[model samples]
Target: MSALDGLLLERVRGLWETVSGVPVTFPPPGSPAAIVTAPGSGLCPPAWVGIVSLGRSALVTAPDAAVARTLRQALSSVPDDALTCPDTVRSVLPVAEVLGPATLAYVTEGTFRPVPDEGDVEHLSVDDPAVSAFLEAAGPTDAEESGLAEVTSPVFVLRTRSGPPLLAAAGYRRWPCRTAHLCVLTAPERRGQGLARRVASAAVAHALTAGLLPQWRARPAASRRVARALGFREVGSQLSVRPELAHRPTGVTEGT
Candidate 1:
């Protein structure tokens, strides 16, 4: 790996280590996956188990020591590359419901290939009503998945010069280790127009200008394509798995 790649990898390792509250050292290539237990860590939706893999090294985190031990034993024979695969995880932990097999990508200023703005890109508050309306039109699944509403940084938006409507918007939340976790959304009808690239470029440029590493975590092929177009390197994968016992209903139903 180049020095720049090594530096970026260390930044990401530090971020996950902080979030998981445990050392997140990746095992050597072709080695058994390393496992640690870190309950209540920032695994989305409070997963019982989480796995992250960089290059050929992988780390598995569980909720407790016992679970970690079990996972270690079960996964000892699995290849590092297979650690993030849902089926591979589910085979060993049958009760696990996987949350993501998202690709973890990062871009450095030296590597960023920004797209030119197709229109005026405006910087707006995260709470802008137009953003909310745009998300509403995009639907709950897209809104939640985009994470646009949760960004702590200024939202970059693209719109028709004559109107208040948004064609696309992007922003980021500052994450541990000087990382900017990006959130981008484009109107469904406005997709394929390169609006996502435009707004995301603005957000990425802003993050880079502030001396922060830009992170793009994506599961969708289209989203990954945009990140690749902007020169983000896909370095790893993240998967969160919730065991059946941990699945609790928010509202209990009475006996019928």
Candidate 2:
């Protein structure tokens, strides 16, 4: 790997270590599949499990040691690159529901190439009523999926000088590791117009200027495309699972 790639990998490992509240170690590239465990971690909701795969190595976080042990044994023989596959995860944790296989992409100042700001792009408080209305117009599913409401940073918007106003909006939530988790959304009608790219560019630039690593966790192809356009590198993936055992009667056991 290039020196830059090595640096980026270190940053990612550090971020996961903080998020998982445990040591995270990666095997050398092309090494046999390997995983590290973080028990009783806050990587996911209580009773849920989270897995992050960075090529030949992965980190698995579970609510408790018992669950972590079960996962470790179950996934022991799986290839590292297949660790994030939903089907593989589901087969091993059959009673659990999988949440994602989101592409975890990141961009550093050296890699970031901001899109040219077009039209009138403005920075506004995340709580601004205009932002709310825009999210509402984007529909419940899209709005919730965008996660714009969770942004702790200023929101960037591209709006129409005339007509229906908000065309697209973007922002980031500051993570504990100084990672900026990006959220971007474009009005359904305005999607193909490059508005998402414009607003997202502004948000990314802000994050970089603040000395934060910009992270893009994208599930949609279009969103991934926007991240790639801004020079974000897809270096890994993340998935969360919640096992049905978590909801069983207190006296119930796994063998039961």
Candidate 3:
């Protein structure tokens, strides 16, 4: 399936490596890492205890006694903002979404395709000016900035081609062995237009063309509406948390 680009996914994998003092060893061939979000289980390797919190998680690739000792020490010495020790992770539970074969389709009407934003708006790809405007609107947070890269991030935006270009930003994580998780943004004034939906389609289309699946992971009700319009049916939801906002986990990570 189509997943995050080469660069953006490194940012995610790198976060765990940097904070946990362990290597993120991806599985080879037919069997890949399972999407681990829950407390008791996930897509973990035979010996690895894979923990994934909203903002941070501790991954121990080795499951032996020595590895367990290493993990304990790693946790103890980790800073308050460490991937597993962060305040936001403690408040939420594991993720739960309905699983199905990747079959998400596009909205059938003439409205949701990758049409340009319009005279005062332009719907361009990642390198286009419209996407640039959208990122400015998103205002990258502290951790996001730490991991941000121009070409690696799965960042996309919508820019109004009007006076003094404005934007809106959105983003998502790349699930291993699946598709490029989408993140989107747009100018506040650009709300209500189907431009967001269109931008999402464009991103998914890119993933599909690459022989990868584009998954719509987490989002709010408004954003979910866009997904519905784009032909994605809800199968399940995960317990989502924002360590960045409150320094601890607080909500359910929704999905499906």
Cα displacement (angstroms), candidate 1, residue 228, comes to 0.5
Best model number under TM-score: 1
Sort by TM-score, best first: what order? Answer: 1, 2, 3
Report clashes for each candidate as comma-separated counts.
Answer: 0, 0, 43
> In model 3, where do residues sit more than 4 Å from their true spots?
1-133, 140-158, 163-174, 240-256
Residue-level lDDT for 144 in candidate 3: 40
lDDT of 1 by residue, 1-256 (tens): 9988888887787787677767666667778777887777674455478888887877777776656666766788888898888898777665546778999999988899998765589999988899889899999999999999999899999987798999999999999888899999999988988889999999999999999999999999999999999999999999888755443233322221
Clashing pairs in 1: none
Distance from true position, residue 232, model 2, in Å?
0.5
Which window of 10 residues has the lowest lDDT sum in candidate 3? 97-106
lDDT of 3 at 213: 43
- After superposing all C-alphas onto the true structure, candidate 1 shows an RMSD in angstroms of 5.6
Error of 2 at 125 (Å): 0.4
lDDT of 2 by residue, 89-195 (tens): 77766555777889999999888989876547899998899998998888899999999999999999987878647889999999977899999999898887788
Candidate 3, residue 204: lDDT: 56
Give the winner by lDDT.
Answer: 1
By summed lDDT, the worst window of 10 consecutive residues in model 2 runs over: 247-256
lDDT of 3 at 101: 16
Candidate scoring better on lDDT of 1 and 2: 1
Q: Candidate 2: where are CA atoms >4 Å away?
A: 27-42, 246-256
